[model samples]
Target: RVKETATHKAGAYATVTVPAGSTATYTVTVSSGGTSATGSGSYTAGTTINIYAGSRSGYTFTGWTSSDVTITNASSKNASFTMPAKNVTVTANWSYSSGGGGSSTNATLSDTKVEFDKNEVDDLKVTLKSGSYNLRSIKNGSYTLREGKDYTISGKTVTIKASYLDSLKEGKHSLTFDMSGGTDPVLTIIVSDTTKTDPQEEKPSVEDPVNFEDVKSSDWFYDAVNYIYKAGLMVGTSDTTFSPYTDTIRGMIVAILHRLEGSPKADIANGFTDVGSDKYYTKAVAWASENRIVSGYGNDIFGAEDSITREQLAAILMNYAQYKGYDVSMRADLSKFADGESISPWAKDAISWANAEGLIQGSGSQLMPTGNAQRSQVAAILQRFIETITK
Candidate 1:
């Protein structure tokens, strides 16, 4: 409390009052992405506050935000900071899961069913659309084909052992490919008589179309696959296979984007602890990260090898486009999709822009926003994104 006294000349005196106690207080408000036990609070000047974020299934907490001060642990679930002398607003952040975002499959075999005409010196070789396609098991009836003993697998080629081939009966037999994490259709093998001796037809030279033996020119993603390969933004799983149905990992996509940027020298520090210095994508990750084109999971982990989803890719591309001076504003409404709500809140704007710009399409009425992205889809989207920007 304060009091003031005034004297007018020597005879008259007046009393006055003055306000006191002017300590500043601040309000701390939390935002979206996850729920907080304490939504908001009030604190006196220079008061320290501890804030922790809750975890959501299939989402990772990327930290908090405040207008007044830099968040101490922006990427961790638990964080704390001192309150400033003004109203402070902080928000929770999360990244979507890329492991299971879509229903799309991987590149399949050109000949889902293979036939053997000769067995004496000929090996039953199967070619996959993607060299990296996972082969869980090959089953003939109840007997599983031993990987090294019965056959050998390398890159896109799967070879049947000469010993196994010789022991096979000369009747119609079937082999089934059991694999995971791909959209590849069912592939089968038929072993017929192996005595016919005839010269095989000439193979297509490398100068031919980008079509691998497995990818027909008539396939939906043929053009997109070819465009990316020719543009050097992407390539086949091997010299001849594109693995169109293969899941594209976070690291691989960033590398592709980096290439599209003409492999510019970013000279940015590698902030992610997961990306090793000896990794092929280390420089690319550093560049994309430095340019604000990509983000890692909380705790400084990028999950580089983890599969990325369509919406995730959309968000990433949106960031890259904006960095390149492209307009990524919300031009399209996404309420039409059945799973529109499945789109992560942080990715809503980017997905909206991609959808509005016609850079990405949905499955009938479903956007499958949380589904994993296939390599073929990446190629197609990358082509569309590049065209949109260049045009």
Candidate 2:
């Protein structure tokens, strides 16, 4: 039996080394001056050490602590102590396990400390901008933005620098910036085409024929009917009859004008009481009346749905010609027409103007001044109107 030592004084000290990949167990005995106390410990090679002090019947055991040492096992069982990589001070403490049993032992372990080195940075700021537009602002870190992949702020320009971007794929790209903050203006960039054509003209499609059996076969009305139908400017009643000979109403004429000039600008005046804002032809009629293209019958009442006469159609064509900036004031006299008196006082000047512009011509020697204007006549007038505008 090994002689027991006193707990009040240093008990027994021993140092043992186990080979790598192996383990060993040892017994540490505590003595209370003359009495011996029991304890056991186990250690593994390579990186760890376990110290255990066996239970003493009247006394309890406390664990170990060091700056570098980590306790792997619970502190409740045997007091386990882990050895540090470098030499340092450590402590193992204990007191009485029973109410008045009393206790003692162990001070700091000596020489255990370690050292190492590395690099770090502080206070870094990153910004992104494009052509007077600021994108993002970042601070306090190393910012590694890709050339083209990462965009940045530089003064007024949100620059997508060329370094990381592919030159082959380089072209103007439109960027829409959210300007809600009022800090930057929204920007759009077009890379390739600067001019875009009208969508309607881009794809040319054939026009549908205005279904008038008699006039569809007529050479004079063919171009007019085709042009209006193709542009979706006109459509026949049903699939068969255009009712070309039926007189066009004043409202219908206005509808045609609304379609023809692609619905030109119009303003409503306070004088017209019958014209309501919600009416379908209100704007069209207002435009025609204001521009002197069409007017009322009597007492300022525009007969909007009344059939239009040849003289009325002539006046409309003349006003349209004048609106197109054509000079047509000389051809007022229809001396060859037998019923020249039948021409309305309000229509004479416009009729003369249309005749002077060569937009209106008599069938043979007849001026047809009082004749009701047909749908074919209206189509012819529209065709001439289109030609005038194109020129």
Which candidate number has the best TM-score? 1
RMSD of 1: 27.0
Off by over 4 Å in 2: 1-215, 218-220, 269-279, 330-333
lDDT: worst 10-residue window of model 1 = 199-208
Q: What tens-digit string does per-residue lDDT give for candidate 2 at 5-94?
A: 222123443343444444343323222311232222333323234344444455456654545445555354333344433443334445
**Which candidate number maximizes lDDT?**
1
Write down the lDDT of every candidate, Cα atoms only.
0.70, 0.51
Candidate 1 lDDT over residue span 1-391, tens digit each: 5654433222233343323553565676766645433435655545556566655665556668766777777777667776667877778876544333433346566576656654445777777654234568776654466678677988878887765655444445566676655554554545565454443322212244675766777788877777777777787788778888999999999988888667767666788999998876888999988767888877899999999988889889887766543445556779999899999998898888889887778989998989999988898888787666534
Superposition error at 119 for model 1 (Å):
62
TM-score for predicted model 1 compared with the true structure: 0.48
Worst 10 residues of 2 by lDDT: 114-123
RMSD of each: 27.0, 33.9
